[model samples]
Target: MKDKPWRREQRFYSFSTDLPTRYADMDTERHVNNVAVLTLHAEARSRLHLALFGRDEWLARTHALRPAKLQTDFLEIAHYPGDVAAGVSLVSLDPHQYTLAIGLFQDGACVGLQECRIGHWHEGAWTQLPALLLDRLQRFGLTEDVQ
Candidate 1:
């Protein structure tokens, strides 16, 4: 037999947020669409952005983080009548970019896993991460209590 592409996962993240599942996110098959899952990841990432960089600066785009690449693996189906939580972890760091892994969890199970690379943008160009930004990124972890 050929090697399996996906395997069992045992990973956690630093930040997490409960996300709403709406009728709009469901499809005819009664499952959340891939597009909706991607949106959920964005929502979680936006929270991280707000935490690391402040709301005003994030909104004003004084510094920006653009998604370079994204990949997702759907593991289970998420049902309604409850909220799902996206757990985000900063996996790797570079001078100008970083990688994040997110787990979409519902009913105590991870429905999906997402990995994305985000690059810094400043002065209309992708720039290296500043000292302050890098320091902040390195300090993030799952130390805070989770609900």
Candidate 2:
């Protein structure tokens, strides 16, 4: 499937990290292990959260945003000992819910895509997102020019 065209008009918050694929990340077929994809998704999500909220302590003390679901599609095989760039985009917005779109690119080609749904957890329940949190997320959406 083709990737959705990024809506560049919205402001998207992004961060890039160079990740080295380890030997252990390779499966018997000689490509990066399927399980390793989850680790990359986790790392990307953590970085995006940190960029938006500043730090883990800040999140625990103030923000109610929590990941509710994650889905990933592997478009191509990634080999061990290679570098990958992960780009995250805010694809949709809602008061209580949002979706983050992540693309793992290698050599300028997308190797995988991940979509994460995040929701606010409050008062022992998943509640409608607070205005403050929604405002914070809006800043992470990609700008029209960038998309």
Candidate 3:
């Protein structure tokens, strides 16, 4: 079978961090619920932002991001009382838009995958990315055009 795209992305991960699967994150089945998966993605990406741009830069940024598309595929059940980590990669980048790919892993196995397109809004319009920021993004492996 053809390899999934995100599988090739592990090496290019911009950032990754452990994320506790709180008891509240589990559903009736005792596995992580779908909504919590989204939270994990957000947390991972936020951590990246904090690391790369710092809190002040992030807070003062003028671009407002709106989710354009979100695709999630659940591959396996993620059980609690186990190790969990989140990995994030910049799949596409634009001045006022970009896409991120995230993975939720439990016990060293990927349990969920998500790819989301976040559109940027600046001054009531889609803005172009500054050259320096674009260079940084490319360094983080956003080597292709925005999708």
Candidate 4:
């Protein structure tokens, strides 16, 4: 899916964190690898989830929040030796699944945009999101963007 018009704006994200680019994250071309850029988004999302749900609870619910899908749009090349500002915003949510929008920025420009859908499951079928978890998600979600 395409990113929203406001996805590149840092203010659009409710959660923002800076991650340092490592030499290993660079490719032979001297640009940060695409996979490494995705990894930055993963770290950002993890931090957001951890902040929404404390350590103990996050661990307990880890198995249920399975990654259902991931779509990434590479916007620009990110060079090494600089920090990438990773931002995450909640895009949509339902009883069984929710979508997260992530943007990776370097030198104040958006380098990539990614959307991840997480499905909540119990036993062998889709399950409703826990009351507490849902409440926290709503609270931490981007007010104007959450659906």
Model 3 C-alpha lDDT per residue in residues 1-147, reported as the tens digit of each score? 013754434454567888887888899999888888778777887777676666876666525655678888777787777656887878777666678877777776787777777765667776665555556666777634223
Name model 4 segments beyond 4 Å from true.
Answer: 1-3, 145-147
> Cα RMSD (Å) per model?
5.2, 4.1, 3.6, 2.1
- Weakest lDDT window of 10 consecutive positions for candidate 1: 1-10
Which candidate has the top score in lDDT? 4
Query: Which candidate order results from sorting by TM-score in descending order?
Result: 4, 1, 3, 2
Per-residue lDDT of 38-114 in model 4, one digit per residue for the tens?
A: 89988888888889999998889888887789999999999989999998888888777888988889998998888
TM-score of candidate 1 against the unseen true structure: 0.81
List the lowest-lDDT window of 10 residues for candidate 4.
Answer: 138-147
Q: State the lDDT of candidate 2 residue by residue for 1-147, as single tens digits.
A: 134544211123266666667888999999887789778876777777777767864467345667898778887788877887777777678877888877776666677777888888888898987665677778766423232
Error of 2 at 70 (Å): 2.5
- For each candidate, the alpha-carbon lDDT, in order, equals 0.74, 0.70, 0.70, 0.85
**Highest TM-score: which candidate?**
4
The C-alpha TM-scores of every prediction are 0.81, 0.77, 0.79, 0.90
Query: What is the model-wide C-alpha lDDT for candidate 3?
Result: 0.70
